[model samples]
Target chain A: MQQMNQILRRIPVWAVYLIGALPAPWLFYQGLTGGLGVNPIEALEHRYGELALQLLIGVLALSPLRRFLGLNLLKFRRALGVLTFTYVTLHLLVWLVLDVQVPSQIWADIVKRPYITVGMAAFALMLPLAVTSNNLSVRKLGPRWRSLQRLVFPAAILGGLHYVILAKGFQVEPLVYLSAIVVLLMLRMPISGVLTRTRQADST
Target chain B: GVGLAGMAQGAAAQETLEPNTWEEITSYNNFYEFGTGKDDPAKYAGALTTEPWSVKIDGLVDNPGDYDFKDIMSEMTVEERIYRFRCVEAWSMVIPWNGFELADLLNMAGVQEGAKFVAFETALIPDEMPGVRYPILEWPYREGLRLDEAMHPLTIMATGIYDRPIPNQNGAPLRLVVPWKYGFKSIKSIVRITVTDVEPPTSWNMSNPREYGFYSNVNPNVNHPRWSQASEREIGGGLFAKRIPTLMFNGYEKEVAGLYEGMDLSQYY
Candidate 1:
């Protein structure tokens, strides 16, 4: 475990950001060259959204990983958060400019469709988190920064719900994503005290 | 005179229409019996056996028996029809289909006096169709239309696209092409067609009645629950293509609007 931590320490945070951003262009290139099948725009839109959700799951899993297994991924959390926001933005852009071009319909969909409404709400929640992700805001806000970042919990849930609602019929793939997010959030609960109390009671 | 005017208009529409390439039409499909993904049918449909195909004509028909594909083809006069194919998923395509009017096929079987509806069913081979193993939709994909809609001149049982027999992915040997309705209503790779008095259950409508109505007509005003139906992205329009406004009844309003004259489209939708 110590050796693994030492190896992880040597990996710069910038490398995480660089490696994360690579899929964005690689996917775009594939879409351009007919590699994303026939409906490239729709495929590209879905791929970006899926990637964003996966990264959001990664961001949510960090604290739980540290708490349960003592595997610290604190250094890459900021990079992962930024990357999640980036993919989310790309997903939104693909829907806006490529998949759906009409301005009125875009606004109408955001307002009217429940799935779109949830998705936009999730994006809105992440906006402030992305803006405050830097060190300067962390220093200025002090402990309040930690409280503000907690918005990610709800944002993650909403993100999963957006996918679940958007999928046609009952699809297991979207439900799995929502389930994973819920389990990660449950793990973050302060349960050590509860566990110790149960152990004490059993001993008596 | 009205028939002449309609023919002239159809000719004009044909002149303006640009049918999608054979590759695009075949590769991008929504035959959910094969799978849900657009490319799934293309990837897996090759395993399906289409040779010696036969269609069972039952229900209220006078001659209820398995009609061989070759015999049916020999009896009918096939022609090209340029149509605007609109999917419920808000995607559009222009297709030049070759087939006989569905009314001719129905007439051959001789519809009984009380028949009010026509229901069609797709072939369900679990070994060939991997998606059928899971209940993505009720297997043996079913679709139905009013007796008049079935007899309409525009409704065809398409066997080929672009002067070639349709590939399995695009519903090999035979398929329904109801130009005025959403694409799913035009059931693919049909094995059975039944004329009946009662309204038969359609696969999509049975799955989600609120989202998919019995009519399944293309109406821009009526939005799907998940997405707007006001506009559609044209398939094969490349990455930056802008979505165009969807037409009422997919631009066959003049021909099909009278069928639902007194009914509310929004309620039915």
Candidate 2:
């Protein structure tokens, strides 16, 4: 386990960021070269959105993994968060610039569409987390940074919900991903300890 | 009409419009009964048994009975028509289809005088079709058209495309092709055709009545509550491709607009 930790430490955050960002240019190349098949815009949008959600889920899993499994992925967590935001931003940009070009309609879609509304809310929540995912902000804010970063839980839930709502019918894949996130969140929660502590305080 | 007469010349005189490539036709499809993904039907539809198919013609028809697939093919006069197929999802395709007019088949059935609507039903084999496990739509996928719309020359029963048997993904064996309306209205893998006086319940309209109306005529003005219908991106185009303005009736207004002459299209749509 110590050796494993040393090996993980040897892997740099820059390498993580570099590897994480690879899908973007590869997807762009696929879209440009017609490898995305028919309806490349939709394919590109879906791929970026899925990658963002996956990275966000990975980032969320880090804490629980370190606490329970002796696998400390803390060093790469910030890079994963930033990469997730990057994918989400690219997804939104593609939808705005290429798919729905009309400015008025774009605003109308964000306002009126339920899925888009939830998705934008999730993105909005992620904005602050991404902004603060740096050493300078981490040191300055200290404990407050931990509290602010907890917003990722809600963002992750919303991201999963967005996918569920966007699918036209009962799709197993999206539901499976959402269920996995739920399980991860449950694992991370301190429900039992909180309840026991409250009971002890009442006795005192 | 001159177009109908030209069709009598058979395959050599086939009209080819802005036709989608054969690769596009076979690779990309949205037959939800097989699955929802564009390529899912292509991947999973091999389990569907399309050959030796028969269609049941009943309800308000004089000659109501089961018609053998091969017999129908032998009896009807086949023709070629290149048509623009627009889906309600705002994507469009141009296809060259080979089949006879639906009117010809209706005439063969000897439609009773009371018949006002022609209803269609697609095959719903749950064991073979993975999508049927989920109720995306009430099973057996139903669609309908007004008697006049069914009788229109543009409405055909397509059996083949590109002079080859249609791939199973593209509604093989037999399917309805109403060029002017949204593609979903053209039910695929048909198993039954019923002539009824009352309007039949359509699958999409039943699933989400507000979003999908019974008429489902391609209209640029009336948006599908979720998305705009003002424009459509042609399939096979690359990402960042410019979408073109959608035409009213999908560019078939000159031929079919008169069918809804006195009614309000916006309300009906």
What would the per-residue lDDT of candidate 1 be over residues A1-204, giving only the tens digit for each residue? 667778898999999999999999999999988888768999999999999999999999988676556688888999999999999999999988888788877898898899999999999999999999999999999999999999999999999999998877656679999999999898767685476457668879
Q: Model 1 off-target regions past 4 Å?
A: A190-204, B1-4
Give candidate 2's error at residue B216 in angstroms: 1.1
Per-model TM-score versus the true fold: 0.94, 0.91
Q: Best TM-score goes to which candidate?
A: 1
Q: Distance (Å) between predicted and true CA of B64, model 2?
A: 1.4
Q: Which stretches of candidate 2 lie over 4 Å from their true place?
A: A1-7, A190-204, B1-16
Which window of 10 residues has the lowest lDDT sum in candidate 1 chain B?
A: B1-10
Global fold similarity of model 2 (TM-score): 0.91
Of the true interface contacts, what fraction does each candidate have? 0.61, 0.53
lDDT string for model 2 (A1-204, tens) is 778999999998899999999999999999898788888898899999999989988987887687556688899988999999999999999989989888888888888888898899999999999898888999999999999998988988989998988876456778877887887798777884475567668879
Q: CA shift at A153, candidate 1, in angstroms?
A: 1.1
- Of candidate 2 chain A, the 10-residue stretch with the lowest lDDT total is A191-200
- The prediction achieving the highest DockQ against the true structure is 1
